[model samples]
Target: MSTPLKTLFDLTGRTALVTGGSRGLGLTMAEALGEFGAKVILTARKQDELDAAVAHLAGLGIEAIAIAADMGKPDEPARVVEAIQAAGQSVDILVNNAGTSWGSKTEEMPLDGWNKLLAVNLTGPFLLAQAVGRAFMLPNCWGRIINIASVEGLLGHHPRMIGTIAYNASKGGLINFTRALAAEWGAQGICVNAIAPGYFPSKLTGYVLDKHGEELRGDTPRGQLGCDDDLKGATLLLASNAGAHITGQTVVVDGGASII
Candidate 1:
């Protein structure tokens, strides 16, 4: 008889692609996946950063590789997929963690800025999924797609200081896309889900945290910014066997902030 612990959450033979895997939230989720025994391929624009993150994962006894590609580019996703396929590896999991945000008054935001945000935050994931999903997932009859979204997708940002209309819209669209993909692919044994984080000390929030760390923490029910470990369980639960039956769900990792 197999133990619950043995069968649940086991990712021993899985392969993953984590875009924006060089730092912050991306790296955190990549590390968690590695810890659960998945071979992780990290991709980002900066080769130096990807190299560093690959080295760090190696130190943890995880087999990781760095692929330097700008997922934001229109053609780069196919190139990155080709690189992975050339290595004779099939993607079993994809963490669409590459994203960007620009903050400015909606009226002041340039059209280019809006388009850029959608390219990285929304289009990139869709293209990557379409490429990888068709090549590997649909053929093998199994896969996982985890998009890293944000709480701002669920609710509007503070009117007094909120400035990123494009970011908010992209995230909202991402959530809906996750649900739609999950619904369509469930029969094919592919699970598509999202994780909406809140107030993490990532590069995107460094400026805000630097300026108002104390004030922000005070407002949060948890009284502290989200830590790296905070993302591990949820991600693993969604990516591994533990979540085989769960699909198209957005698992919010915020510390009760949305509840309050």
Candidate 2:
């Protein structure tokens, strides 16, 4: 019998690990997964933030577990996988949303800033995906890996926009990372994909938006910034079985910003 369309999207009995899920985009994605019945594990650098995120999910009747692990740190990504294993749960969906950004002129940007951005934005996702795939997904032969790239990955920074060479570089690399990983893992029933979002109101973009909100809106073909709910459907589509046949693709959710 064919599975119903509704059944294809059901995530019951699965587990999702969302890095930097304590707030903002990460939290929003986590909520979508949990709402569809996946047990969620939220990880970030701050315990308090994780706790609050868990509380917020609970308020929505979505039970979630929290882990305070910084994705930027060298050892934290593997440790997150280990901790979840110790809890007797395997990650079926891995959302690499924990990241940092630095804005500066190319010549003036310090090496440290560039390194930090790559470490979190590119390296962290690679490590988490590797760990989860090796520890669980590869062995189980089924999983979803969502790397949260950005429109910055797809286009050059506008002259009026802030300088963010390293941010753009890392995100651009991530889009290819998604393609490469998917090609390698697709035969194993692992679907690797990316979501390249445009500017949305979040802690990560608060300052950028404050400085160039109107300019950004003007550039977007939609003539508006992304809303809080903009990412929910994209996240769900890629995270659930509804996206079973989709792999090695980048879903640009920039409200037509990248088009113009």
Candidate 3:
């Protein structure tokens, strides 16, 4: 008999770790997973924001825990994982959503800025995945790894847009990292995938959107940028049995922004 649709989407008994879960896309994805019955562990650099996020999740009746850690720090990922483990929870799902960006004309970009952005956007995800898989997923032989990428990864930034070559390069690397890791670990029952979002007014991209909202909207076939709910469906699928057979893929949630 075929499994019921609801059964495929259920995430009960699962624990999800969402880096940068203090706000924006990360929090949105956390909400999706939690709404489906997963216990969520939200990690970010600021404790106050995390506490507020936890409270918000609690108000929605979703079980959540918050940990503050900077992904740019080399040792932070392991700390976050160990903290969760100490609480008797294993991360069944990991959303590598913590990232940073720097905007400068390519030649004018500072080396330090590029390095910092890459550390968080690319290296941080890899470290967190390694720690989580080694500690929890590999032992249990089941896990979901979702990397938050960007449409800019698949396509170069528009000439009119502020230059963010480091951000673009890091996200591109993440997309390929998802594919390679999925191929390597699929046999172990770990699913690796990515979601490349379009313009969304969040802490990270609010300034860009504010500066070019009309142009971006006009460019998209949907005539709008992404919204709070835009990333939820894709987040839930990749984090649940609903997408068990899916791996090594980048799902673009850009309202058709990259099609052109």
Candidate 4:
């Protein structure tokens, strides 16, 4: 492809912050943004893991920095925002990829587990968005908020899938949150959207992958589960200049799994 065509997906002069970015899907998304020319800031609870992730990205010739923060904490968002500002970075692209999942029967699930899932999956994203938007994005009149949701948000879990009530509910809330925020913020130049992934091989889906790898691959019409690279194209479409007009929607990247 020509350089000009590639420019549509370029993120030059952009700064991105991704939560839960030390490993798994967050790091995957961070790699995509950084590789596309965005200066990326990655956050997770462990400083050492973040350091390793940053080093990996740096080795790839991408500018990446790692910060330590637990997004699940009520006050941590503010601290994270402040840390980014203190480093002289204002997030232009915010990927709310920090999330947690727990599974149990409705009656068997602990209240603590339910609350923890919501705290990370739903509240953390909103708080971080609020911090970044109010502190930076609004003044600049340009921003992108990409929520990493799941197909479970749209449809109930399969009987074979086991308990994930809290996860499902939180993701559903996140989708609605994206729409509501987009409706109010579209004219302000902030685009809120989501990507509802299906059967990605991440920490959240490791159990299923370990147990039903063959079954998952065979059941999906595409005959495959998602890989880290699978997220890059959809992510760039949302974060780069190409997707300016797109907002308030969830782009499902399930490789035909959901439809099948």
Candidate 5:
């Protein structure tokens, strides 16, 4: 007999680690996994934020915990992996969502800003994935890696409207990283994928939303910005057994914005 559809999406024994999961898109995805029966671990730079997120998840009756670690720091990935190991669990799902952005004109962009964005947005995810995969996934021979890329990664943004060249480049690199890593690890039962989200109301895009909310809405065929729940479904699909055969793919959750 074939497996039931609901059973395929169930993640009862899974553990998920979500970087930058204290707020915004990361938090949204974390909640989805937790709600569907995965134990979730949230990582970010702030202990207070992490505590609050854990409390929120607890209120929702989801098993959750927090680890305060800045993904940009080189030593932090090992620390995060250690924390999980200490808890007597390994990550079955990894979400690379911790990132930072800088807005500046290309010619006038500061070298420091460029480097900082790349470190946090691109390099951080790479290191963390390496640590987790080595310590857990590779050993167990089963894992799911969901990279949080952006629509900006898929297309160039207008310099005058949004000066985030480094951010765009970093996310673009992450998208390809997802594809490359999937190819390398698929034979070992590790599925790697990416989610490229469009505009959503978060601290990361507060300034842009304040200035161009209407303009962006007009640009999107949906005539609206994404809500908190917009990313939940796509994330669940990729994180569960439902996506067993899906790997090396980027599911764009932009309400048809990228289509145009």
Candidate 6:
């Protein structure tokens, strides 16, 4: 028989490690996981931001802790995993939400900017997944990896809209990474997926919103961008038993923008 609805979604004993969880989409997903009963471990570069996020979760009665680490650093992923292990916990869910973007015309985009975007948006997630999977998930024979991709990955951005070629390329690579990793890990009980968010008003996209919010919203069939809670349901589904059979998929949380 199938598990009960509530039971399937219950994450009572699970633990989640969310990179970039101090703010924006990372915090949104972390909040969802914590509210649903997962003990959340958030990692970000700034200690103050991490502390604030932990306190916010605490106000909601969610058990959460924070570890300050720069995902772009080569050694930081291993360091984060080691710290978690030292805490006597293994991550059941890994959210690769730590990322950055660089905007410039394709012809004028600096090599350094491209490299930075790729390092944080693509390479960092790959390193974290490898370390966390080897240390915790693969050994335990169960895991969930959710990569935060962007709609720019799926569709090219118009020059008039925003020229972010490097960011788009990185996210596109991340989507395929999700598929490839899922294929390799599925039999071992690890499910990998990506969330392709359209345009959310967060610290990362505040400038874009301020500049072209109306035009972007008009482009969407729903006539709006994603809100703070837009990702909650999809995140819960993939992180819980409700998504056990789902893998190697990019769940787009855009307000029908991709479709229209």
lDDT of every model, 2 decimals: 0.91, 0.93, 0.95, 0.91, 0.93, 0.94
Model 5 segments more than 4 A misplaced: none
Error of 2 at 108 (Å): 0.4
Q: Quickly count the clashes in candidate 6.
A: 0
lDDT of 6 by residue, 73-192 (tens): 889999999999999988999999999988789999999999899999999999999999999999999999999998899997877866899999999999999999999999999999
- Quote the positional error of residue 75 for candidate 1 in Å: 0.8
> How far out, in Å, is residue 92 in model 6?
0.4
Worst 10 residues of 6 by lDDT: 154-163
Model 2 pairs in collision = none
Task: Evaluate model 3: give its TM-score.
Answer: 0.99
Q: Model 5: per-residue lDDT, tens digit, 2-40?
A: 889889889899999999999999999999999899999
Error of 1 at 89 (Å): 1.0
- How do the predictions measure up, each by TM-score? 0.97, 0.98, 0.99, 0.96, 0.98, 0.98
Scored by Cα lDDT, where does model 4 land? Answer: 0.91
Off by over 4 Å in 3: none
**Candidate 1 off by > 4 Å:** 1-3
User: Least accurate stretch of 10 residues (summed lDDT) in model 1?
Assistant: 1-10
Measured with C-alpha atoms, the lDDT of residue 22 in candidate 6 is 96
Q: Give the CA lDDT, 0 to 100, for residue 113 in model 6.
A: 92
Per-residue error (Å), model 6, residue 206: 1.4
Candidate 2 residue 163 C-alpha distance from true site, Å: 0.5
lDDT per residue for candidate 3 within 1-260, as digits (tens), equals: 99998999999999999999999989999999999999999999999999999999999999999989999999999998889879888899999999988889999999999999989999999999999999999999999999999998899888998899999999999999999999999999999999999899887887898899999999999999899999999999999999999999999999998888
